[model samples]
Target: MKPINLAAYFLCGSNRESFCDRFPSYFLRIFRSKECPPNEEYLLCGSACPFNCSNPRGPVLCTDDICGEGCYCKSGYLRNDNGTCVTMDQCVGKDEVCGPNEEFLSCGSVCPLTCKQPEPLVCGLACGMGCFCKAGYVRDTANDKCVTPDQCPTEQCLNQNEVYDLCNGNCEPSCDDPEPICTKICKGGCVCAPGLLRNSAGECVSVDKCGNYTDGALSQYMNVINKILHL
Candidate 1:
C-alpha cells in the first residue's frame, strides 16, 4: 500500500493522542514508509488538497475543525455534494425570478406591476378628478382613450336620456324629441294650456273670450253702454 500524506494526517488530528488512538493504522503506515527509498512514489489520499494549511485557500478551507458554515457559492460558483466547490456560468436575467405573491409575470425586463397589490389600473385617458368612466364607457385599447357608450338616436327625444337639456339649459320634458316647431319664450308668459292667452288680469283665456278684460275695464264699458242704451 502507498503511504498517506502527513499533512492530511495532521489536519485530520492524527497528532492528538485521542485522535491517534482511533487512527493507529495511520501512524503505523506513516512510520513504516520512512524505511522506504527516499524517491519512492507514495500514493497520497488527501495531502494534495489545494486547501491544505501550507497552501491555504483563504477562509474557504475545510480542516477537521473548520467546516464551511453559512458559505454559499458565489454567483458563479457551484456547490458540490461533498462540500467541495466548482465554478459555473453567471445567471444573466431576472426572467425566472418571481415575487412572493406571484401576481405578475416578467416581461423579460423590469417588473411592470407591483406584485404586492397587483391590482389593474386604468391609465392614460381619464375623466375629471372626481369622475370615473361611467357605465357603458370603456377604455379604448387602440388609442388608450375613454369613450362613452354608443347611443341609438331614438328620434331626438328630449333630455337625451337625461344627458341633455333645452331652453337655456333648463330641463323640460320632451325637449329632445323631434317636434314640428322649435321652443319659444312668450312675451306675456304662458300656462300649461295651448292657445291660452293672458288677459288684463294676467289670467289665461282664449282671445275675445269673457275673461279678456279686467273688472275696472268691464265697469267702464258697462257705464258707456248704459248711457247709450238708456238702461
Candidate 2:
C-alpha cells in the first residue's frame, strides 16, 4: 500500500461523505481559519456558542464541548442578532422611541425609583435594556406612568413651617447643631422650610422663637443669627 497523504486524503477523496463529517476536528480547524470581520477575530478552538446582546454572560450550560474554528466577537463586544459584533451601548435599536418622561437605555438600573420606593437604599449592578424614567422623575405605579416625585399621591405637609421635599437631607437646623454636615444621600419626606429651625419640641420655628425653650437654645439661636448678619 502507498504511503497515504493525510492532508490530501481529507481534502479530496473518492467518497460520498461530506468533508466536514468525514474529516477530524483538527482538519476542519485548519481549513476554517480565515480573515474575520471588523471587531471580530478568528478563533481556532473557540466556543461554538457565543455571547450575544440577549444573553450577555452566555449560556450557563453549553452541552456542546467540541471546540470549532470561527470568527468571534472581541473583548468588550457582543454579537447581535444580525451576526454583527458591536459594543454594549449599540445593542439597543436606534429607532426605538420611549414614552413621555421616559428614555431608552442600553443598560439601565434594575432598581428604578417608584412611588412605593422613591429612595432606594441599595441598587444592584445588574442592568437591562429598556425604557426607564428620565432624570428628576419616578414611576407612579398607581397609574403606571412616569412623573416627577412630587406628583406621587401622598399626604401634603400641613405645618406651615415644614414643606414637602422630594429629596430631603438628614441634616436640618435644630436646637443642637444649627449647622450640621449631612451626607449627599437623599430621603423623600417632609423637612423644615427655608429660614426655619426645628425647636426642642420637634416643631419648626423661627430663630427668635427657639429662645423660649432654654438659655442654651437662645444662645445658639443668637450665634446663628449673628453669623448670618456678619455682626
* Candidate achieving the largest lDDT: 2
Consecutive 10-residue window with the lowest summed lDDT within model 1: 103-112
lDDT of 2 at 181: 71
Regions of candidate 2 where Cα sits further than 4 Å from its true position: 1-98, 113-124, 135-137, 148-155, 212-221
Residue by residue across 31-98, what tens digits does model 2's lDDT show?
33334678886677777667676666466688658776677777667788888998766876533335
Across 25-125, the per-residue lDDT of candidate 1 in tens digits comes to 66555554454343221222322222211111223344544332222332223333344433322122222221222211111112122211122344544
After best superposition, candidate 1 residue 48: deviation in angstroms? 78
Q: What are the lDDT figures for the candidates, one per model?
A: 0.32, 0.69
TM-score of each: 0.14, 0.46
TM-score, candidate number 2: 0.46
